[model samples]
Target: MNLAGLIFVLVTHFLAGRGVMAMFGIKENKRKTLALSMIIGVVLFHFLPVVLEVCHIAITATSISIAIGILTLALFLPVSYKLDYSVLKITRPSFTLYEALFATLLILMVIPSVWLCYYFPVFARDVLSGPEPLAEYAVREHTLINSALSVDLTSTNNHLKPPFILGLQVIYKLLVHPFGELWLSIMVCSFLLMFYTLIRERVHALIVLFIMMLFIMMPEIYGYMYIVLSDYPNMVLFFLAFYYLGKYLETKQANTFYFATFLFCLASSIRSETVVLIGLIVPLLLFSFIKDRIKPGVIALRLGILLVIPYLLYYVWMNVFVANYMHIQFNTGEQLSVTSDSVNIFFDRIGIILGPMLFSEHARELFGYIFNIFLFTLALDLVLWRKKIGLQARVMLYGIVVVLVGLPLLGAIIPWFDINNTTKRGVFKLFPLAAFYMANSPTLLQLSQAIKRFEFPELTAQKNAAPVMAQQQKIKKKK
Candidate 1:
C-alpha cells in the first residue's frame, strides 16, 4: 500500500476503536458502533489521496501514526471526567409500551434504507470489491478472512475485520454462509424477534407489528435491509440487549438479569463500542441498586461486580490481543485531525443516506399515509395497555431507555462528515434500535384505540351495578 492508503486504513481503525472505547464508558456495549466507526475513518482517509499530491504535502509514516493516536485520545476526552465506576448506581425501573413500539418501528424503517444505499451503490460500492490497490491506506485488517475463510474479505476492506464486520460475518455463517437472497430474510428475523418480545399484550400486537412493517417511511432502514454490512445486526443486538435489560430492571430476577447481562456481553463482543452501551447501562442499573444510600462497602462491591469486572476483561482482550497482536492500524494523519469536524462530516452524509421516494424527499408524504391507516389501531393498543398493564406500561420504561441511550447517539449523528468515522457508523447502527423504541410510541396507541371503536371488540360495562354503601345506609335509615 502507498503512504496515503496506509494513512487512511490505520487512522480509520484507530478512530473507530477509540470511539467504541469511549462509548463503552457510557453504554458499556457499543462494539458495533466502534467497529463501524473505523470503517468510516478509512473511507474518509482514502476518499481523495491525489488531493495531497496537488497540495504538495508528503504523507509520512510518523504523521500517520501520530494522527491515529491523537484521534483516539480525542474520542476519550468526553469521558475523562466521568470515568469512575460510581456512575453505575442503578435507578427506578418502569415500563411503557410506547417505548418498545418506537424502537421496533424505527428499526423496520431504517434497515431498508441501509440496504438501498448499498445495493444502489450510492455511498461506497468498492466496499467488498477492495479499493483500487492503493499505497497509503491507513490500518491493516481483513487479514483474518484471508487467513481463515480463504475468501477475499479485503474487497470492501483494505486490511482488517472491524469487530462489527466480524460479528456480521459470524452471524451470516451461523445463519447462512455465502450470503444470498436470504440475507434480507435473516435481517428481517433478527429485527422482528427483538420487537416481538416487547409485545406482551395480544391486543396491541397486530397494531404495533403493522406499524413496524412500514419500512418505507424511514429512509435509513430502507437502505440497510439488503446489504452484507454490520449495521442491521448490530442494531438488532442493541435492541435485544436493552429490551432484556429493561426486563431485568423491572423484575430484578436472577434469570432476567443473567439473560440481559449475557446479551449485553454478546453485544460488546459483536461491536466494541457497544461496550459503552453496556457500561452506561450498568451505572444506570447501579442508580437503582444504590438508593437508600446502601452501605458504602456494599455499594462498592455491587458496582465492581456489575460494572467493572466484565468490562476490564473485554478491555484487556481487545487491546492486548485484538489490536496489538492483530497488528492492524485503524487511523491516519488526515483522518485523525482532532481539531477537524469529524462529526460534521458524519452528519453531512445523512441527506444522501436518507433522501432517496417512498424514500427521503417525500418522507412527510409517506409518514402521513402510514399514520392514517394505523391511527385508530394504535389508540386501541394504549387503552388495552391501560387496562392490562395499569400503571406499569412498558412504554414509559422505553422512554427512559431512549433518553439514556439516545443522547450520545444524538451527539454522534447531529454533525455530518464525508469522512468515514464513528459518528456515522453509530448513526447507521442506531436506526434499528430507534425503530424498536418507536413501535411502542403513543402514536401506535392512538391508532389502535381508534380501531377498537371500529373493527375490534370492546368489553361492556357491568349491567348489574352494586349500590354504593352510602346509598344503602341512607335507604335503611328512611325505612
Candidate 2:
C-alpha cells in the first residue's frame, strides 16, 4: 500500500507539473519545466483538496483523481499543439573521470539517506507538537476544519499553522490507511530529488551531485529526515522560489516569474515565518523594474499577481479560518517590542545563535569540512569570476546571510520566542540555497579545467589557442 502511495504521488505530481508548465507557457528547458511542474503539482495537491473540503465539497479519491485529470488535459492540450518538441530535446552532458567518481559518491549517499528515512522514528518534538497530530485529526474527520470540536492532540499554536503539510498528511493517510514512516520517507526523498533536479539544471552534474551529498550529509538534515517537521520542506520551497526568481532576472522570462510566484505562495503557506521571503523578494522586484525600465503599470500588475494577491489570500486564510475557527490567538503584539533592553537582548541572542555555528566543537564536527570548502570556493569564485557571478548567485548569497544573521536578530528581538530551540531549526531553511551556490562556485569549474589540463595539456592548449588564432587570422585576412 505504501509502495502504491509512493507511485501514485510520483505520477500525480508529474502530470500536475506538466499541466502547470503548459499553463504558464514554460518550454525553455524540459528539466526545469518538470521541476517547476512537480512543485506546482504538490502545492495544488495539498491546496485544492482542502479548499474543496472547506467549501463543503466531498473530497473522495475519485473526485480528486478526476479533478487532476481534467486539469492536466485542459492545460496540456493547447500547449502541446503549439510546442515544438524538437526544441525541448537536451543533449546528454558528458563528464570526466573525476566528475563520474563524484557523481557516484553522491548517489551512494542518497541510498543510505533514503534508508534512514524509512528506518528512523518520527521523534522530533515539533512533529509531535504540531503537524502530525493535526494531520491525524484531519484524516479522521474526512475534511479539514479548524474548530474547537477537533481533537486536541497538539498545541493551540499548531492548530494555527498554515494547513499545507497537514492537508498533505491527511491525503497520505486517506490513500495509505496505515500511514507510518512511509509519508515522511516520501517527503524526504521527494525533497532530495527536487533539490538534485534543480541543481542539475543549473550546475554541472558532478557539482550538483557533490552538493546533494553534502546537503544530505548535514547532521541536522540527516537527523530530521524522518521527522515530520516543516523546516526542510520550507527550505526546498524557498530555494525553488529564489532559484526561479534568479532565472527571471537573468532571462526576463514570464514563465520563470510564474513558476517563482507559485513556489513563493507555496512556501509562504507552509509556515508564517516563510513570509520573510517576501521581504527579500519585494526589494528585488523593485530593483528589477528600475533596472529594466519596465512600465509602471506592468510592474504593478506583475507584483500584484506574484506577491500581493497570494499574500493577501494566505493572510485571510490564516486569520479568518485557522486562527478564528480554531480559537488560536493571533498574538502579533506579544511577539515584538521596541524597548532598549529588548534591542540589547536581541543582539545577545544573535551572539548565542552564531556562537555554535561559528565556534562550537559540535558545529565543527558537523559542518566544519563543508563550511571550509564552501568558504574557500566562494572566495575563489569571487576573485576569478566576479563578472560571471550572475544575479541568481548573488541573491542566493544574500538570502543565506539574511537567514544566518537576520533570523537570529529577529529571534532575539521577539519577546515571546525561544531563541535557543528555534534558531537551529530556522537556519535549516537556508541550507538548500547555501549548498547549491557553494556547489556552483567557479571553483568547481576551475578545478575541472585544471584536471583536464593536467590529463590532456595539448587538448587544453588547442582549445585556448583556437579563439585567439581565429581573431589573428581574421585580422590578417582584413589587412
Candidate 3:
C-alpha cells in the first residue's frame, strides 16, 4: 500500500471515534482531542514497519490492507465490550430470529419496492445491458477492475471508510471471473443485512432489501459495490453503527452501547467523517453514567470509569503518542465550514449561501433551509431516544450544517466553486448524518414514492412512523 494510504487508514479508522468522543461537551479541548486523534493515527500507521519486522514478515498489498480493517474491529470490540460490563450499563435484546425476519424483509425487499418506483429507468438500463455488463468491469487477471474508471491500485486513497465494498473488489480480483452472479448474491445478502438492521424483520426484510437495491442499482453505485469504492461500504458501516445505537437505546444494553460507540468510532476511520457522529455517542455515555441515575445495583462508578477510561487513554495516546509520531495538523475551519455560507450570504456576498432564500422570497428560502432542518429535527425526534443518539446527532448535525452552510462561504472565499474530486466526491460523506435525518418511514418509502408522483404528506407522522407506535407519535413529536 502507498504510504499515504496507510496513514489515511490508521488515522481514519483507529482514532476517529476516540478523537471525536474526547471532544464531547468540552469547547476548549476540541482541538486537543483532534490533535490527539491525529497522533494516534501516527502510532498506528508509522509503526507498521516495526510491527511487520517484529513478526519477521513482509506485509502484502492485501494483508496490510486487510490488517488495518481487522485491527480496528479487534481494538474497538473488546474494549467497548469491557466498558459495558465495567460500567454495568444495561442490556436488552433488540431482535430474536423472528423479529429480525420481518425487519429483514422491510429493509431488504420492502424498501426496494419503494425504491424501484423512483429509479425505474436506472434499473431498466442495468437490466437491458449485455449479459456481461458486469463482466466488462469484473476484476481482471492483473488483479484490478477491468473498467478504465476503476480506482488506481497505486493511488494513495488509503482511508477505506467502508472497506466491505473494497473487500468485494479484492475478492473479485482473485476470482478472475464475471461478477454478475456474485453481484446479485451479495446484493441479496447486503439487502438482507440492510433491512434487518433498519427494520429488524426477516420476512419484511426482503421487501425493502431491494428497496434501495434499484436506487443503488444505478450504474455508479451498483458498479462500485462490486468494483472498488467506499460509498457502499460507508453506507453499510454507518447503518450498522446506527442500528447498534438504536438497539442500545431501546434495551439500554451496555453491550450494545459500548459496541455501538466503538463501531461508530471505527466508522470514522472507514469514512473519515464518522468522527462527527461518534462525537455524539461518547458524551452521552459519560453523562448518562454520571447523571442519568440508572443503577446497575453494583459497579456504577466502575462502569463510569470504564466508559470514560478507554476514551481517556485513547485521547492521551492520540495527543501524546500518535500526534507526536506523525506531527498531524489540525484545522478549526473544518467545524465552521457549514454555516460559513449562510453567514457570508448574510453579509450580502455575491453568491447566495441559502441559495435564493437569504434574499428574494427571504422567508421562503429560510423555510427551505428549515425544511431540511425540520426533516432533521423530525428524524432526530424519532430516533433520538437514547442519550447517545442525541450526542451522535449533535456531532453529525454540526458537520451537516457546516456543509449546508459552509459551501457558500467556501465558494465566496474561493474565486470559483470548489470542484476538486475530493470536494465533489466527498460531498456525500459530509452528509452521513443527514441521511439519517431524512430516513423517516414515509420519507423512506411512501413519501419517496409520493415524490416520484409529485406530492408530499401534509402530516408527516402519518407517513413515516416505523418502529414508532401510532399512540406514541405525539410523544415523539413532542420529544
Candidate 4:
C-alpha cells in the first residue's frame, strides 16, 4: 500500500472540501461540516481524473499530484484569506451513554467491512467487466482511453456507462491501493456520519442509535458499503440531495438549495437513469415554490437548474465523452417502449416486487425486517395512530414513491431494466428514504420523547414547568 499517497489523498480531500463549504458560505455545526467537507472533497477529487482524461494528460502519479495541487489551491487559496484556525484544534464532544454505545457499535461494525474491503480482491462481475478492468488498464497504460477499449466483451454494456466509478478507481489505484476501492470506504464512512447528523437533531440519542443500526444492518445495503459499485454512492448523493432540499425549505438558505441541486447533478452523472428520477421530483419542487409564493421567474430558473444540469451532464457523458472514446453506437431510443404490453409489464414487475421479493424468506435474508417495520409503522400512522406528518416526512414518502414506482417505470420503458438485476440493485435507493420516514414517524417521535424524559427527568420537569411559570407571570401582572 502507498501509505504516504493514501494520507495525501485523505488530507487534501478534507481540506479542499472544507474550502468549498467556506467559499459557498454554507456552515453547519462542526461535526456535520467536517463530514460534509470530506464527502464533497472526495467527489470533487474524482473529477480530477476525468478532467485529465479529457485533456489527454497521462494518468500518472505526477500528473495526478499536479492536478490535485491545482484543485486544492483553487478551492483553498481564496478562502485562505480568512481561515478559521479553530479548525486545527480537535476538541472532543462529550457523548451521552447511549451515544457512546451506538458510536462504538457502529465503529465495530464498520471496521471489519473496511478491512475486508482492503484485504479482498475485486470479484463483482459487473465491476470486473467495466470499471475495474478499465481502471486497471488506465493505471497500467497511463490513459483513460486505453487498450481495454480495443477488446470485445459482448456480455456486458457497463463499458458504455458513465465514468463516475472508473474515474475514482483510477485515482485510487494510482495514489492509494492497487485494488483502488478504498475511495468507497471514505464515501461510506463520510455518508454514515452525515446520515447520523441528519436525524440526530430531531430525535433522542437512543432513537438515533436504533435508526442508524437499522440502516446499517440491511444486509444488501450493508454489503454495498465495501463493494465498489455506483449504486451505493449514487444512493448517497441522491438521498442527500433531497435531504438538503428539505433543509432549504425549512431554513430557506439559498446556499443550501444550491448545494442540493449540485448534489442532484452529481447523482445524475453517476447513473444516467438518475436524470429521470430528478425529473420526477420537479412536481414536488413546483408545489413547494407555489406554496412559498415564489415568483414565476424564480421558480422557472430554479426548475431550469434542477432539470437542465443533470440532462447536460447525461448528454455530455453519453454523447461527448463516450463517443469521443469508443466506436460503439448506442440506440437508447430502441430501449424505450410505449405499448399496452409495457403497462402490463410494469404491473407484473410491481407484483413480483410486492409479492415474492418483499414477503419471501429470501427477502427477509436480504432486507431483514427493515421494510416490514417501515410498512407496519406507516400503517399505524395511516390508520390507528396518525400523527400529523411533517413536511420532511412527507418529502421522504414522496422519495420512496419515486424510487419504487420509478424503477418499474424504467423497466417498463426499457426491457433490460429487469427485476432480478437492474431493478434489484436500484431498490437500494429506497432504504434511506424508508429509514428517514421511520425517524420522522409519530410513534418513533413519541417514543423518543419518552426516552428523553426517562433519561433526563429534571430537564423534562423544567420543560413542563416553563409553560405554567409563564401562565403564573401573566396572572400576577393582571392582578
Instruction: Report the lDDT of model 3 for residue 425.
Output: 33
TM-score of each: 0.49, 0.84, 0.40, 0.95
- Give the Cα-based TM-score of candidate 1 against the true structure: 0.49
Report every candidate's CA lDDT.
0.44, 0.66, 0.39, 0.85
When superposed on Cα atoms, how far off is each prediction in RMSD? Answer: 15.7, 3.7, 15.1, 1.9
Clashes of each: 159, 1, 60, 0
Residue-level lDDT tens digits of model 1 in 1-479: 13353344444454544454445432322333333344333322221222222233343434434444455566656655655444345656443566466666656665664455334421234334332112212112212322332444533333332333433232222222322123333345434543444442423555655545553444445544565455555565556556656655675554555545544554554444565555555556667666545677865765565456447545644454345644444332233343356356444444433443213335444232342333343366566644543212353344335433543443443332222343335444433444444454555555555665565343312212335656788899999
TM-score of 3: 0.40
Where model 2 places Cα greater than 4 Å from the true spot, the runs are: 2-5, 28-31, 58-60, 66-80, 83-104, 116-121, 146-156, 180-210, 323-338, 365-368, 381-388, 468-479
Candidate closest to the true structure, highest TM-score = 4
Q: Model 3: how far is 142 from its true place, Å?
A: 16
lDDT of predicted model 2: 0.66
Instruction: Tell how far residue 146 is off in model 4, in angstroms.
Output: 1.2
Q: In candidate 3, what are the lDDT values of residues 281-358, reduced to their tens digit? A: 444455655565666653355345434543553353335333443233333244343444655543453243333432
Best-performing candidate as measured by lDDT: 4
